[model samples]
Target chain A: MIKVLFFAQIRDQLATSELRMPSSENHNIEMLLSNLKARDSHWQTVLSKTNLLVAVNQTISNENSALQSGDEVAFFPPVTGG
Target chain B: MIKVQTTDFNLQAEHDKLREKSSVGAVVTFSGLVRDINQGKEVSSLTLEHYPGMTEKSLTKIVEQAKSRWNIIDCTVIHRIGELKLSDQIVFVGIASLHRQDAFAACEFIMDYLKTEAPFWKKESTTDNESYWVDAREGDLKALNKWSK
Candidate 1:
């Protein structure tokens, strides 16, 4: 399974801190994102934000990054801490 | 040392920790405080949230980058999470080096990178009883460009 997490405003908006999904080695971030966006209109709107940030396995990653089973993925807003 | 905690930290203690080496000649520190006002709104308090594993990894990477670019002898970073009131300390960055220039530059560089690279977010509650997540500033992104060039 792939562990997906959300934080900050995205978490507040989605009301989900985390979820687990069955994963395949063929799955990449973009495909996972599209699968998430397909859940509902609210998910679609929130996940579709242009500035949304993603990380794979605790490192900053882009949508093109590949995923594997048991990998951890996170989606959050741009950082604002000092 | 890098730490993310909910409790407040001592500035003098952090400074002393970074300046432990006898060869260190200068120690520079920067602390961020929760402001009473932001963007014309009267902020009453701030709540910080971070990804547990990722926050540490990102902060370590930033500190490593600073060490590589400067003659840093030692350093300490402490970032406070959870709710914080006005005047409360939010973050601290301290760098020690053999010269003042390296300590100062590395201190600022770590802060600049931390603002954009670390996995932290702030939610501000105003005096009017409204709360909202602060948006990331475009200027913060631009801050990184200066270091690259």
Candidate 2:
């Protein structure tokens, strides 16, 4: 399972917070995003913007980056990180 | 020394902590404040957020980098977190070195890198009933690139 993290106002709005989903060899970050948006309407609203950043582990990730088992996926609005 | 805390810090006291006996002839500091306005948005307060463990670790590394790159005597960095009001002091960086040039240059260098490399995030709450996360400014990233080792 892959670990997904959250932060900011996004974290403020969460209920259960963080998740572990079955890892798939064929699915990349783009697919994971699509799956997340499909499962949760809240995610759809927060991430509908194309600018949302995806980080595999702690580093900013490319859309096409492949997901590996035990990877941590963090999806947040374009990192306003200072 | 470096600290990331929610308590408001005394600028002078923190500075004095680094004033121990040594050959250091210069001391420099940089403070970041929560301003009243930004691009016409009337900001009433600011909140600084950071990844707890990662932030302290990154800051320690940054201070070490400065020590290696300059002939410095002492350094102190204190950053405030949680809720802060308008004109409230948010962050402070202090550097002491043998010469003023190294002190000034390294202080700016640390500030610039802290702005970009550190995992801290700022959100501006305005009187107009809007809250938005401050975007990482392009100029800040550019500033760090200029001093890239």
Candidate 3:
């Protein structure tokens, strides 16, 4: 299983902080997000936003980044703090 | 030194600590405060949230980058989280070096990187009880880009 984290506006919008999901074959960030988007319309709207930021294992990541078992993934809005 | 704390910090104490090195000849400090207004909204307070482990890691990386790029003797960064009212101190960056130019440049670079790279989010509460998350400004990204060149 992989740990999925959310923060800031995305956390509020989805009303979730963290969850765990099973690792899948050929899993990558894009597949994880699309799987999440299929959960509901609200999730689709939030995950589909073009500006959403993602991190894999606490480092900035893109949709092309591959995922693995026990890897942590995070999603958040653009940072606005100094 | 890097600290992300809920309590307020003492600027003089932080400065004194940074300037303790005998080789240090110039010290530069910058503080950001919560303002009464933002984007035409009358802000009453700001709430800051940060990803715990990730925030520490990012801040450490930023400090390391500054040290690598400048001849800095010592440096300190303190960022306050949680509820902060108007005029409250939000962040502090202090750098001590052999020359003023290095201190100034490193301080600015750290701040610019912190604005975009750090995992911190701020929500502003208005006088009318309305609240909204602040959006990232394009100017901040451009500011960070300047350091890369």
After superposition, the stretches of candidate 1 with alpha carbons farther than 4 Å from their true spots are: none
What lDDT does model 1 reach? 0.93
- How badly does each model clash, as a count of residue pairs? 0, 1, 0
Candidate 3's error at A4, in angstroms? 0.6
DockQ for model 3 equals 0.86
Better of 1 and 3 by DockQ: 1
Error of 1 at B110 (Å): 0.3
- Tens-digit per-residue lDDT, A1-82, candidate 2: 8887766655565553488877873268878877777877887776676656666776667779998788887765533432
TM-score of chain A of 3: 0.96
For candidate 2, chain B by itself scores a TM value of: 0.95
Indicate the docking level reached by candidate 3: high
Candidate 1 on B19-101: residue-level lDDT in tens?
Answer: 77899999999999999988789999999999998999999999999999999999899999999999999999998999999
Candidate 3 has an lDDT of 0.93
Once superposed on the true structure, which residue ranges of model 2 sit more than 4 Å away at CA? A9-17, A23-73, A77-82
> Which is better, 1 or 2, measured by DockQ?
1
